[model samples]
Target chain A: MIDTLIWLVALPLASALATQLLPRYATAIVISTAIATSINAAALLYAVATHGVMLYQIGGWTAGLGIALRADGLSALLLMMAAIVLLASSIYASAYFNDNPLRRRFWPLWLLLWCSLNALLLSGDLFNLYVTLELLGLSAVALASLGGKTAALQAALRYLLVGLLGSMLFLAGVTLIYAGYGTLDLATLSRVVAAGPIAWSALALMTVGLLLKTALFPLHFWLPPAHGSAPAPVSAVLSALVVKATFYLVMRLWLDIFSEVVTPQAASIPGVLGAAAVLWGSWQALRAERLKLLAAYSTVAQLGYLFLFFPLLQALPAGAARDAAMGGLVILALTHGLAKSGLFLAIGIIQQRSGHDTIRDLDGTAQRLPATTFAIALSGIALIGLPPSGAFLGKWHLLAAAFSAGQWLWVVVIMIGTLLAAAYTFRVLGHAFGQQPYPRHPVTIAAEEWPALILSAFATIGLGLAGAPVWQLLKVSL
Target chain B: MLTAHWLYGLSGCLIMTFGLRAVLLNDSLLQRIIALNVMGTGVFMILITIAYRGPDAAPDPIPHALVLTGIVVAVSATALALTLIRRLTEEQDND
Candidate 1:
């Protein structure tokens, strides 16, 4: 089972290396790797489900001496989400970049990015996480620059600088932890950690570093341009997987490793920024002119919702209520990962057809591509937290938790964000339904269209309707 | 010995603060990239300092290994950032 974890990371890495040697077969190699890893992810999920939390110590070494790979319920769920989203993105990229010159470069870098993501998700060691983060950051920047346009290059550079800075700060925090505790393993740290200046300082550094990487609220200035200007598939992964990875780290550090050091006052800081992000990001999304920019801003708002879980967790005593809030957060994250990637892919198709992604100008193209438009609508429903979508249920539980805890301020924030999301989502839909005099040219829907449609449908109808299993998955005792 | 550790830690923090300030304040891409590397090096020095002990004691190998890995990652990032910067300059020149 643990050997599969090694292969899950190594397969894509080896394929990435192979793609460089045989660029002609790079597409085939990448697609096969994606499929293979999806199976591997499923197998890992099943193994964890049946066997409970499994920790694979690298090289058969014991604690405090060597690294380990941990797969708990949360890690397994995230791995499966990543596998699904990346598989869909990979399939879409094959058709989306069919005739493009940059496809060769994209396949290799994307595989490397995928490899880093799996490695990051599985890594239980702090230093290993840092290494994987560096790998993920570099590959992500490289993929963003595959567009070869000035805007793309500029966005990539800015992203690289921000990411490097975040990594350095995070490493500094890790240094402080190691200096104080003499261990880099999270499990060991959690057991040994105590409330102290060193621990508090380390938590602050790591939290801020991760917030920057996650692009939560004020640090999110770099996200829109980077996500909006990248190629469609790159944008999908950036919004769906890469940003979420950092947030996942923040949660791990706060709730698990640094739980001993984290005070309620300190926890409320993210909660406050989260509220700000909800209002500010939604306003930005509502005002965005470009379709992709709107989606990018929506990501910021959705990430804000993820942070809202923190205060609820802090407020509620450790029991069913806290677990329910955590489950809601997970559900929202998983749903958003699916829906946002679908939204981006749909926008990509729209851009290809219309030759631009200016939301108001997409009337004719949107009319021509019904499947893609429907994809957007379905994802839009999920994003807006409408009935029968995963986000709807997730936010319901979150709001319930918030209300019960007497945190009415968060209730108001959620209400405002939902309305704003609806406004922005429908803004594109309104434009899509416009009447145009130009004769309808039949648009050939490519193979790429299906992945977005399927994923969005799963998010909207599937997860919304049958979220019990997800809640069940989350119920596995820690 | 305790004074030496404090001095090294304090200096590391100062170097990091300076590097971070430089990175944030600079408008030039090269300066920002260089500043980021400087910031990373400061962190590495701190890790090394933490690993240091008395003259007779063997230094902890963990931070040494970590610093080595950090250097590789930092170098790769710097190289990639430089390449991107060069491309940006070329595109601007063409424009």
Candidate 2:
């Protein structure tokens, strides 16, 4: 049972390799990886349902020596999210990349991305995470460059440079941890990490690196361009998944490694950063002229919601804090994953048809692409924290926790973000609602619109299905 | 031991400051990349320094491991960025 953890990594990786071998039959690879991982996801779900948590020690070694990979309440929930999103994205990617002549070579890299994402989410060791992060970054950059336009290459290059710097910093921190503790296993590192200047310094270096990689606020100068310029599927992956992987590492380290040092001082910094990001990102999003860039900036604002957990947790009791903070973030990630992907997918269709994503130009486009319009509406509702949506549930608990903690500043930021989300969401929705008078050109809907609609449906309705299980999963008794 | 740690820390701070200045003042994107790489190297040095226990004691190999990986990743980035910059300039020139 324990050895089965490797399947989380092994299957997608094998498919990635297979895609390289049989590049022509790309859909086969996509279908197989999705199917294989879907089965694994079901198995994991069943295991978690019957048993509590699952642990796999690498190479049959014990926890302290080789490495221990454990799926607790938090890990299992995220794994489920990753599996669903991966399956949906692959389905969408099949249609998205099919007609693009430039990206005929795209499927292998996309599968590679799926492999790395799945592997990154599941890997039990720092070294393995490092390996998977590289794979994710490289594949993402290549995909970013797939647009074959000047701006796309520029964005990919910028992304490439930043990614290298980030990885270096991450590796350096990993080194410091390895030296200080003599083990890279997270569980082991947590128990052995003692309070000292060295430990604190390592934590600081590690965080600076991750914060940059995650594109959190001031360090986010690279994100808008990279996300803005990439083709839609690529943008979806970059915005929805890749950013979170780096942040996921930060969460893992903070939760397991520096759980002790989450003192009063450190609490307010991430909180302040989160609050600032929410306000600043919303303003930026509202200001942007292009739809893709607007959506890109929206990601910056959405990420701010996740960072709220840091301070909210600090202000509450242990068991309750984990309940609110972790649960909020996980649900936030899951919901935003579906919504943002759907939004990007729909925008991709709109762009393909209209041949532009510039907001000012979209006078009327509703009648022809009603499904796309509906998709945008659904995604917007989810993004805006409306009821029966995951974002709302996440936001509800987060706001409740904020009030409980008396973090009025965060509560205000949350409200402002919701308003901004509604504003921009409506702006797009409004365009799709009106009729497009035939003037310059007629738009064409591809075989692509339905996938976008399906994703949005999942995001909107899937939240309702997930509600009970999610509540129980949040019951992390520490 | 602490003195050596300070040495690495000072170097890292200097590089970071230089990077800030370079990013601020330099119009050349290439120079900015150069500065970024320099700053990254300095950070790598700092991590290795943190791994240092003493002149005689077992030097922490974790930072060494990190440096090894970081160097490879940095080189790949520099190469890729250079290619993109070249292509960008080409497109601009064509325009």
Which candidate should be chosen as best, given TM-score against the real structure? 1
Once fitted onto the true fold, the runs of candidate 1 whose alpha carbons sit more than 4 angstroms away are: A436-443
Which lDDT value does model 1 have at A88?
Answer: 93
Question: In model 2, which regions exceed 4 Å deviation?
Answer: A61-68, A436-447, A475-478, B1-27, B31-68
For model 2, the interface Cα RMSD in angstroms equals: 2.8
Restricted to chain B, the TM-score per model reads: 0.95, 0.88
> Per-residue CA lDDT of candidate 2, range A1-478, in tens?
6555678777777877777787777687777778788778767766766677777877788865565667655566666666776677677678777767654567778878877876776666776677677878888888888856787777787787677667656765665676567777776677778878757877877787788889888888889999998888888878888898788878877765687866767877877888888888888888888888988888898888888888887778867555766677778877888888888888888787789988877766666667777788898888888988888888988988988888788888999999998898888766666644543322344346766777777777788457667757656311
True contacts kept of each: 0.93, 0.57
What tens-digit string does per-residue lDDT give for candidate 2 at B12-76?
Answer: 76775576567557778899789768866776776677778888899867567667876776677
lDDT of 1 by residue, A139-254 (tens): 99999888667888998899999999898889989999999899989888898999989998888888888899999999998999999999999999999999999989999898
Q: How many clashes in each structure?
A: 0, 2
Worst 10 residues of 2 chain A by lDDT: A438-447
TM-score of each: 0.97, 0.89
